[model samples]
Target: MAHFSYRGRSAAGKEVKGEIEANNLDLAVEALMRQGVIPLKVSAKKQASGLNVDVSSLLNRPIALEPLVIFCRQMYSLTKAGVPLLRAIRGLSQSTTHKLLAQTLDKVHYDLTNGRNFSSALRSHPRVFSELFVSMIAVGESTGRLEEALLQLANYFEQEMETRRRIKSAMRYPIFVLSAIFIALVVLNLKVIPQFSSMFSKFGMDLPLPTKILIGMSNFFVNYWYWMIASMIAFALGMRMWIGTTTGRERWDLWRLKVPIVGDIVNRAQLSRFSRSFSLMLKAGVPLNQSIQLSAEALGNRFLENRLIGMKTAIEAGSSMTVTASNSGVFTPLVQQMIAVGEETGQIDELLLEVADFYDREVDYDLKTLTARIEPILLAIVAGMVLLLALGIFLPMWDMLDIARGA
Candidate 1:
C-alpha cells in the first residue's frame, strides 16, 4: 500500500489535512469519506531527491523522552476522564508541537476511528511505539484497564528517562575534560610546538628525549589529523552497526557487564528495570508465564533477554520463579533470596516492586559516587598531561640557559 496526503473537510465543515495509507488516491478518498472526511484532493506522498537532500543526516536527532512521558500521562488522564478515544487522540494530535509526533498521533487516531484497536494502531508505527509498549497496551485493552496501564507505562518511561539522565550526568564531566585536553593538544601540536622546534634548531642544541618525542608527536598529528578523525568516525560507525546485530549485541552487553565501575551500575540498573516491569505486569493481572515473557522482552539487553528465555522455559517445565531466577545466574543471591521469600509469602508482586524501588535508589547513589570519583581522576589526567608537555618544552630551554651561563 502507498501513503497519500489528503486535504479534506469534516462533516461539521471543519477543514482537515492528513496522510493515509491506501491502494490508490481513489481508495484513500474512500477511506477519508468513511471517516466523515470529504476529500477535496488526494495525491501520493512524494519522494524527494535533490542535491541538497540527505536522508541519512536526519538520523542524528536525539530521542527526546520528556514529550513521550507527557503524552502517556495526558492520554491516560483523558481516557480516565471519559473522553472518547478518537477524540482524545485528535485533541492530542492538534496540541502537539512536534511534527513527527503530531503526524503519528493523527494517523493513529484515524486508524482507531476506522475500527483498529489501540495496540494495532500503535503497532503500525514501530518507530514511535516499541514492541513492549504495544504489548502492555494490548494487555490493558484485554483486561479492561487501559487507564491504569497507561499510567504505569508513563511511570515506566519516566524511570527510564531518569536512569539515562543519571548515567549521562555521571559521564559528562569526564567527557568534557577529555574534549578540552584534545583541543589543547591540537593547538599545541599545530601551532606552539613547531615554534619551539624551530627555536631549538637555530640554537644548535640537541633537544632532550622528552622534547624530541613531543616534537615528533606534533609533526605526526599535524600531518595525519584527517586520517585520525576519519578512522575514529569509521570505528564508531562500524561498532554501532555490529552492535545492531543479535550476536554482536549480546557480546557487547556481556562486555559491558564486566566493565569495572560502570558495569556494576549497568547491571544493577537493568535488574531494577526488570524487577519493576515484572511487578507491574503481574499487578495488572497478566498471567505469570506471559508476564515473565513480556518482562524479558522489556529488558532491552540481549544477554538478559536470553536468560529470561531460559527462565521462561524452566517455568514451562513447572519450575518455580525462585528456582528459574536462581538458575539464570543474572540475579544476585540477595535478590534471589528476597524473591524466594516473596513467593512463600504470596506477595511476590509487591516485594518485586519494593526491590525495584530499592535498586533505583541504589543506582542513584552509585551514579553520584561514580561521578565524584571520575571527576577528580579526569581532572588529574588533564593536569598530568599539561604538566608533561610543559616540562618537555621548558626543560630543553633551561639546559640551553645553563650552557650560556657556563660559557
Candidate 2:
C-alpha cells in the first residue's frame, strides 16, 4: 500500500486536505469519493528525513492518564450528543491539553476525512491505543454502541489509575523510611564510624566485637566505595536482564504473589482488573476464550496471566470457566463460588462485575490499613538499627572512660 496526500471538496462544499493509504491514485480517489469528496489533486506523501522524524518523536511526550481519561469521557459525550465523529475529533484535537494526544486526534480527524473508520485510524497509533482499547472500539463500531464503549473505557481507565494511586500513596511512607535508613547507614560508615575508630585507637584499648565489626565495615566502605557502587549498578542491570526473560519474570511474579501484606494488595488489584476487563469483554460480546486472553494481559500480573492463559486453553478444550478458575488456584473460594453460580445462571457478566466490585472494596480497605500494618514492622526495623548502632559505637566508649578515670 502507498500513502497519498489529496485535496478534495467535501459534500458540504468544504475544501479538505489529508493523507490516505491505498493501492494507487485511482483507488485513493475512489475512497475519497466514497467518503463524499470530489478529489482535486492526489500525490504520494513525501517522507521526512530520519533525523527530523527521530527528533520530533523524542520531543513528543506520551499522554498522561488523566488527560486520556478526560478525552474518553468527552468523546463519549460528543458522540452521544449526535456530533459527527470527524467533527468531534477535530474539536477535541483543538481542545486537548496533551500536545501529543491533540496531534494524534488531528491526524485521526484527517484519516476520517479520507474515508478511514475511527477504530482503524486509532489502530495506526499503537503506542497510544492499546489492543484492548482498539478492540473495544471496533466492537462499538460494529454494534453501533460507540458511546457505551467509550464510557466503559473511561471507567476502566479511571479505576485502574485510582488503584495505582492508592498503592503508591500507601507505599510512600515505607519508601521514605527505607531511603532515610539507607542514607543514615551510608553516613555512619563513611564518616562517623571512622572518627570513632580513630578515637578508640588513640585509647589503645581492645574494641568490642560489635565495634570491631563496625570498624571493618567502615574501612571497606572507605577503601572500596567504588566497588560497592559498581556492584549495586551491576546487580540492578542483572535483575533487569533476568526479568526481561519470560521464565525469570514468571518466577519473579510468582514470588511477588507470595509476599505477605504487599502480595495481598497486588493479588487483589490484579484480580480486580481481570474481573473488570473480562466483564467488559463479555458484555461487548467477545468470545469466552478471547475474553480470557485479553483479560490476562489487562491483569498486569505475569503469574495470573499465565494461569488465565491456561484457563483459556482449558475452556477451548470444553472445560467450564468456573472449573478452570477453581483449578487455577489463584482465586479465593468466594470468587470461585460466584463464578460457579454465574455460569449456572448465565449471568456471568453481572457476576464478574460484582467480583470486580468486591475486589475493589478489598483493595480500598487494604490501602487504608497498609500504613497501620507496616508501621509496627518499620518500628521494629528502626529499633534494631538503633540497637546495633548503640552497641557498635558506644560500647567501646565505656572502656575509654574507665582508662581516662584511672589516669
Candidate 3:
C-alpha cells in the first residue's frame, strides 16, 4: 500500500490534514471523501533520500515509554467513554506531542476508516508498537474489553518506566565518577606525566621503580596512541558482535544477574516485570501459555526469558505451574508458593499481582539503598588511584631532593 499526505475541508468547511494509505492516489481521495472531507490537495508521501536521512535516528529514535503510557491511559479513557474508535484515534493523533507517534496514530485512524481491525492497523507500525501490545489489543478486541486492556497496559508501562528510572538513577553517580576518573587518567598520561618525565630525565640518576613505571606508561601512551585507540575500537566492536549472538547474549545476561549489588536489583526488577505482565495478560482473558510467553518477553533478561520459555513448555505438557516454576530456577520459593496457592484457588491473576507488588517494593528499597552501598566502594577506588599517582610521581622527587641536599 502507498501512503498519501492530504489537505482537505471537513463537513463544516474546517481545514483538515492527515495521511492515508491506499492502493493508489484515486482510492485515497475516495477514502477521504467517504469521511465527508473534501480533498483540495492529495499527493503520495515522499520518502527522503538516503543522503538526506539521519542515520543516527534509525538507531535511537525510540518512542519514549512515558508517552506510550500516556497514550494508553488516554485511549482507555476515550474507549471507556464510548467514543468511536476512529474519532478517538483522530483526537489522539491531533493532540499527541510525539511527532512519530502522532503520525502513526493518524495512519491507524485512516486504516480503521478503510475497514482494518485495530490490532492489524497497529501491527503495520511495528516500530511504534510491540508484539505484546498488539497481542493484548487483539485479545481485547476479541473479548470486547479494549478499555480494560488499555488501562492495564497504561499501568504496566508506568511501572516499567519507574523501574527504568530507578535503575538509571542507581547507576548515574557511579558512571559520572568513573568517567571523571577516566578523563583524569588520560590527561595525566598524555600531558602531565610527560612533562614530569622530561624534567626527571635531566637529573640523570636512577629513578625509583614507581617513577620508572609511570614514565614508561606515559611514553607508551604518547608513542603508540593511535594503536591504543584502534585496539579499543576493535575490542568494542568485537564485544558488540559477540553480544549480538544468542549464546553470547545468554551468557552476558546470566553474568549480569551474578554481579554484586546490581544483580539483585536486576533480578527483582525482571521478576516484577514478568509477574505484572502475566497478571495483565491473564486479566485481559489471554490464555495461560500465551500469557506466560508474553510475560517472558517483558523480562528483558535473556537468561530469565529462556527459563520462562522452558516453564511454558513444561506447563503445556501437563505439568503444574508450581512444578514448572520451580524447575525454571528463576523464581524464588516465595514466588513458587504464591503461584501454587494461586493455581489451587484459581485466583492466579490476583496472586501474580501480589507477587509483582512484592517485587516492586523490594526494587524500591534496593534503589533507595543502592547509593549507600556503592559510595564506600567508589571512595576506596578514588583513594587507590590517588595513592598510586602520589607514590609514582612524588616518591622520585623525594629521593632527588635528598641527593641535592647531600643527605
Candidate 4:
C-alpha cells in the first residue's frame, strides 16, 4: 500500500484535495470517487517540506500528559455535544498543533473512515496512547459511555501533571542551593587554597596539617579536573544503562523507597496512581484481575508492581482480594483496611477513589513542607563547608602570626 495525493471536485462541485492510502493509483482514485470526489488527478504523496524536519525533536520529543489531557477533554466535549465520531476526529486532527498527535489523529481518522472502531485505531498508536488508555477507551466504546471514560482520563492525566508540577516547584530551591555549594567548593579548591598555599611556601615555614591537606586537594583539582569531568560523565552513562535493565530497575525502585524523607512520599504517590488507575478501570467495567495488572504496571515502580502482580495471581487462585492485599505488603495498613471494607460492601471502586484522594492529600502536604524540611539539611551542609574552610585555610595563618612576633 502507498499514499496518494488526489485533487478532485466534491459532490457539490467544490474543489477538494487530500491524501489517501491505497494499493495503487487506480484504487486511490476509486476510493476518492466513492467519497463523492470526481477525481481529476492522483499521484504518489511526498514529504511536503524537507526543511521543516528537526532531528532533535524527532529523537527527544515525547507526547506529554498535557496534550493527552486536553485531547480527552476536547473529545469529551465534542462527543457529549453529539458530534459524529469520524467528523469530530477529523476536525481534531486538523486543529491540533502538536505535530505527532495531529499525524496520529489523521491516521486514526483514516482508520475510522475504513470502518475500524475508535479504540482499534487508537491501539495502533501505542507510543501516544498507553495500554491503560486503550483499555479504558475500549470499555467506553463497548458500554456506550465514551464521554464518561474520556472525562475520567482527563482528570487522571491532569492530576498527574499537577503532581509533577508540585515536585519541580518544591525542588527548585534545593537545586539552586546545591548548585551554589558546588560552585563555592570549586572556587575554594582552585583559587583560594592555591593563593594561600603559595604565600605559605614563600615563608619556608612548616605548614599545619589542615593547610597541607588543603594544598594537596588544590593541586589535585588543578591537575585532575578533566579526570573528574570524565568520571562524572562515565558514571552518568553507566547508571542510565543499568537502570534500563529489568533487575536494575527493580532494585532502583526498591531503593528509592529506603531513601530518607523522600521515600515515603514516593511510595504514597505510586500507591495513589495505582489505586486511581484501578478505580478508573473498575468503574469502566474492567475485570478485577485485569485492572490489577494494568494499574500495577502503570505505577512506575517495578518492585511494587511485582507485589501487586502477586495479588492478582492470588486472586486468580481463589484468595480473597483483601487477603492478598494485606499479604502484598505494598499498601499501608489504613489502605488495607479500606480495601477490606470496600470488599465487604461491594463498593471497591468508590472506596478506591477515596484511597487515591487520601494519598493525593498526603502527597500534597508532604510537598508543601518539602522546602521547610530540606532547608535544615542544606544549612547543615553549608555550615560544615564553612567550618572546613576556616580550619583548613585560617588555622595555619595564626601560627605564622606567632612566628612574625618571635622575629
Candidate 5:
C-alpha cells in the first residue's frame, strides 16, 4: 500500500493533518472521507531517501531529556484526562516550543492517525525515543496503563537529570583547576623556561642535572610544539577509531569500571540504572526475559551488559533469578541476597527498585564527597609540579652565586 499525506478540515471545521495508507490517491481520499475528514490537499507521501547518510537528520540534534520529561508528563496528564491518542499527539505537536520535538510529534501524530499504535510510531524515531521508552509505552498500551507508564518515565528522567547535574557540578572545580595547571605548564615552557635557559647560557657555567632537564624539556616544547599538537590529534583520532570497534570498546568500558576514584561511582551509577530500569520494566508488566534484556542494554557498560546477557541466558535455561544474578558476578553480595529474597516473595520488582534507591543514595553521597576525595591527590600533583619548577629555575642560580663568591 502507498502512503499519502493530507491536510484537511474535521467535522467541527478544525484543521487536521495526517497520513493514510491506500492503494492510490483516490482510495486515500475515500478513506479520509470515511473518517469524517474532508481532504483539502492529498498527495503521495515522499518515501525516505535512499542515501545511507541523511544530511538533514545529521544536522538535527537529538532532543534533550528535559523536553522528554515534559513531553511524558504532558502525555500522562492528557491521556489520563481521556483525550484520544491521536488528538493528544496532534495538540502536543502544535503546542510544543522545541522545534525538534514538535516536528517529531507531528510525525508521531501522523502515524497514529494512520491507524498505527503509539509505541510502534515512537519506535520509528529511535533518535527521539529510546528502546526503553518505546517498550514502556508498548507495555502501557497492552496493559491499559499508558498514563502510568508516562508518569514513570517522567520520574525516571527527572532522577537521571538530577544525577547528571550533580555530577557535572561536582566535577567543575576539578576541571577548572586542571585547566589552570595545563595553562601554567604551557606558559612556563614557552616563556619562563626559555628566558631562564638564555640567561643560564650567558653565564658560561655548568648547569645542574635538574636545570639541564628543564632546559632540554623547554627546548623540545618550543621546537616541536607543532609535532606535539599533531601527535595529540593523531592519538585522539586513533583512540576514537579503536573505541569504535566492539572489542576495544568493551575492553575500555571494563577498564573504566576499574579506574581509581572514578570507577566506584561509575559502577554504582550503572548498577543504579540497571536496577531502576529492570524494576520499571517488570512493574510495567513486561516479560522477565525482555525486562532483563532491556535493562542490561540500558546500563551503558558493555562488560555488565554482556554479563547480564549471560544472566538472561542462564534464566532462559531455567535458572533462578538469584542464581543467574550471582553467576553473573556483577551484583554485590547484598544485592544478590535481596534478589534471592525478592524471588522467594515474588516481589522482585519492588526489591530491584530498592536496590536502585540504595545505589542512588550511594552515588549521591559519593558525588557530594567527590571533591574531598580528589583534593589530596590534586594537591600532591600541583605541589610536585611547583617543587620541580622551583628547583629547576633556582638551583643554577645558587651554583652561580657560589662561583662568583669564590672567584
Candidate 6:
C-alpha cells in the first residue's frame, strides 16, 4: 500500500484534507467512498531523498507522547460510542493540530478503508507505534474489540510515561550536583588558581604537592580547553556508535541491569512491562505462544528476549507455562510461583495482571528510595571536591604567611 495526500468533501459537503494509504488513486477514492467521503484529488506521498535521513534527525524530532496517549483515549471513547472506524479516525485526525500526527492518522484511516488491517498499517511506521502496541491492536481486531484494546494501550503507555518521569525526577538532584561541581572546577582553575600561581612565582616559594598539582591542572585546562572539548565530543559520538551495535548494546544493557541501586529499579520496571504486556495480549485473545513471542520482542532487551524465546521453545515442546517460565531463570521466584498458581487455577491472565501491578508498585517505591539515597551521596561527593580545592589553594597562602612571620 502507498500513502496518498488528498482533499475531499464528506456527504454533508464539508471539505476535508488529509493523507491516506491505497494501492492507487482509484483505490484511494474507493476507500474514501466507503467512508462517505467524496475524494476531489489524491497524490502519493513523496519519500525523502539524501543521506540527511538518519538516526539524529529521528531522535531530534519532537515526540509528543502525551498527545498520543490522549489520542488513543479519545479514539477508544469514540469507537466505544459506536462511531464507524473510518469516521472515528478522520474525526480524531482532524481534531489534532500536530501536522505529522494528523497526516499519520489520515494514512492509517485510508489504510483501514482500503481493507488493510490496523496492525499492518501501524507496523509500517515502527517509529510511531511500538511492537507491543501493534500486537495488542492485532489481537483486538481479531476479537472485534479494538476500542477496549486501545484503552488498555493508553493505560500501558501512561504507566510507562510515569515510570520515566520518576526516573528523571530521581536523577535531577545528581545532575544539579554535577553541574555545580563543573562550574566550581571551572572557576577555580581559570580565575582563582592562576592568581595563586602568579603570587607564588613572585615570592619564589616552593608550593606544596596539592597546590602544584592544582596549578598544573589549571594551566592545562586554560591552554588546551578546545582539545578537551573536542575529545569529549568524540568520546560521546564513539559511545553512541558502539551502543548502536548489537554486541555493544547487549553488553551495555546487561551491565546496566547489574548496577547497584539503579539495577533493582531497572529489573522491576522490565518485569512490570513484561507482565503487563503478556497479560494484555492474552486477555485480548492472542494465543499463548504468539503473546510470548511478541512480548519478548517488545522488551528491547536482547538478554531478556533470548530467555523468553527459550521459554517459547519449551512451551512448544509441551512444557507447561509455569515450568517453562521458571526454567528461564530470569523471573523471580515469586513471579514463578504466581504463574504456577495461576496456571493451576486457570486464571493466568488475571494473575499476570496482578504480578504486573505488584511490580509497578515496587518500581515506584524503589525509585523513591533510590532518589532519597542518591541525593545525599551526590551532595557529599560534590562537597568533598570543593573542600579539596579549597585546601589546595588556602594551604599555600597559610605557608606564605608563616614564611613572612619567620622573616
TM-score, every prediction: 0.82, 0.85, 0.85, 0.85, 0.86, 0.83
lDDT of 3 by residue, 86-152 (tens): 9999999999988889988998888899898898777656568876788789999999999988988
Q: Which ten residues in a row have the lowest lDDT in candidate 4?
A: 6-15
Q: Write the per-residue lDDT of candidate 1 for residues 101-123, one digit (tens) a residue.
A: 78889999888888878986775
Q: Show where candidate 2 strays beyond 4 Å.
A: 1-62
Residue range 81-200, candidate 4, lDDT tens digits:
999999899988899898889988998898788887888677656568877898899899999999999999999999889888887888799999999999988999998889988898
TM-score, candidate number 5: 0.86
Question: Candidate 3, 82: how far from true, in Å?
Answer: 1.5
RMSD of 2: 9.0
Backbone clash pairs for candidate 6 read none
- Reference-based lDDT, each prediction: 0.83, 0.85, 0.86, 0.87, 0.87, 0.81
**Candidate 1: worst-modelled 10 consecutive residues by lDDT:** 54-63
Better of 3 and 6 by TM-score: 3
User: Model 1: which residue pairs collide?
Assistant: none
Off by over 4 Å in 6: 1-64
lDDT of 6 at 183: 92
Better of 1 and 2 by TM-score: 2
Off by over 4 Å in 1: 1-63
Off by more than 4 A, model 3: 1-60
